[model samples]
Target: MALVAVLILTLLSLGIALSGTLTRLLLVVVPYAVFTLFLAGVVYRILKWARAPVPFRIPTTCGQEKSLAWIKTSPLESPPCLWGVIGRMALEVLLFRSLFRNTRLDMGQNRPVYPSAKWLWFFGLTFHWSLLIIVLRHLRFFIEPIGPCITALSSLDGFFEIGVPTLYLSDAAMLAGITFLFLRRLIVPQVRYISLFTDYFSLLLILGVVTTGLIMRHFFPADLLQVKNLALGWVTFSPFVPQGVGTLFTMHLCFVFTLLVFFPMSKLMHAGGVFLSPTRNLANDSRIRRHVNPWNAPVKVHTYEEYEDEFRAQMKTAGIPVEKE
Candidate 1:
């Protein structure tokens, strides 16, 4: 669900293991295999997308396009240049500009009224950002000499200073976001009608992962030294399961692995897909430049001159006017 951020968790969960052979298989071999599968699958999908042909400039323009010199154009919406397209893509990718602009149509007394429904965007953004932060925080385990930036981020995320373990704002935000999104599917008539099993499954997977992780951190703490060593061992290509890491963490880990293995084949690939999409990546200069289909075969045209030459004898016999006599 969180995309490539799952890479960090694969390292973190190296300590959650079973018996001798099973421990090596689950904690060590499984992480490597799943991560490998995730990476390969994602790359194959992206490359497949890249190979697909775009026949025309079909950018999803939202404003005035570049035409006459005097006409004002919305650069962000109808991006006409490379820089404008890049800027538009940056905003859409980082801030979800298009989603932020989402509107909902409401039937007033007898008329239609379009209103802002920003809560969906807000919750979606919150969930994703929090997930990203949590994933980044786990990098402290993988890297021996942890970067200052990672430490700073972790400190900032848990700066509330609420409890003995220090409650993380990201944890709270992620839980609230996931709950709101899940409830929306159940409560909203339109959303409920369209929601699929996969949609609910994804949310539940993330919720399960977050719930189990929170339990491990607060209620039943994992041995930090062993966990860190296991993580570092993964980083160094030598892995061993450390004893005393509970089954709860293992359960939490299975959820992460499920999400990872499911990610490349599922809708979660939108993280990678958004970049390859012609509608988002292309510049809106359709009127200015002709986008001939690259796949078109070479076409031969019979020139009027050639036709005139070929029919000259017939034209002369028929007493018809001819370009050349």
Candidate 2:
């Protein structure tokens, strides 16, 4: 179903471009509209999360927490201070440190056994890095006089010099990573049982984008000058619609816009949401510091002696023993 949906989208894009009816809409309005939705949705989600009351320290910990002066603590696993939390977050964001410890559990002789499963972590890391590189490489189109860093990175990516246009390692790696991830969900019984349409849709959608992009780059070859002009013009608020950018580019752009629009509402929001995750960003310092909930209501307490004093007169009137009297 996901594949069919992607194909239909591709066909519709090609059909529209061939008809030359909505070229301006596809070229200008769609990009702007999608960008607006993406930005607004991300900001709204972030603000909503910011308003949520944590009320207390609840950082997830794995290793020894800081306690006695003589005891050694694992800062990366169980952060006790701000610096330690920063270090842990760095490792988590950059290296996927927690994912590195991914485990596969099985029942062996009535007892559960856990084995190392690092392939998910590896492919996940590969997909993210490759995607980042590809985005960085494409920055050349939007920025005038293309920065030296992007140029150097692009050169490095095509160092193998495989074809006329020089195949980018990131392109192949991204494809492979996506393939593995998608296949794992379909082939693994545990994952397949839990998988939803959205999971499959996201992967197939990206696959469509990459496939169309690769075809344009290698087979048809989009007009670089026209493409760059369009990208820059859009970025600079002066829209430019150039002819002969090819229907394939249009399809690719559609897929990208769809992804951008879907990003904030989907699980892809994790890209920004990770920074705000209390379990990840907060330090495990419940032992050393107190976290009083400022929202708690204050109340007055009456002691047992006060209660007895107030009841003593009533007790005497009723002929009961009164401690106060």
Best by lDDT: 2
Model 1 C-alpha lDDT per residue in residues 52-123, reported as the tens digit of each score? 989988889889999998999899899998898899999887888899989899999999999998999999
Give the top-scoring candidate (TM-score).
2
For residue 268, what is the lDDT in candidate 2? 83
lDDT of 2 by residue, 213-269 (tens): 999988998999999999998999888679879888888888898888888888888
RMSD of each: 4.6, 3.2
Consecutive 10-residue window with the lowest summed lDDT within model 1: 1-10
Q: CA lDDT of 168 in candidate 1?
A: 92
What TM-score does each of the candidates earn?
0.89, 0.91
Instruction: Give the runs in model 1 whose Cα sits over 4 Å from its true position.
Output: 1-21, 312-325
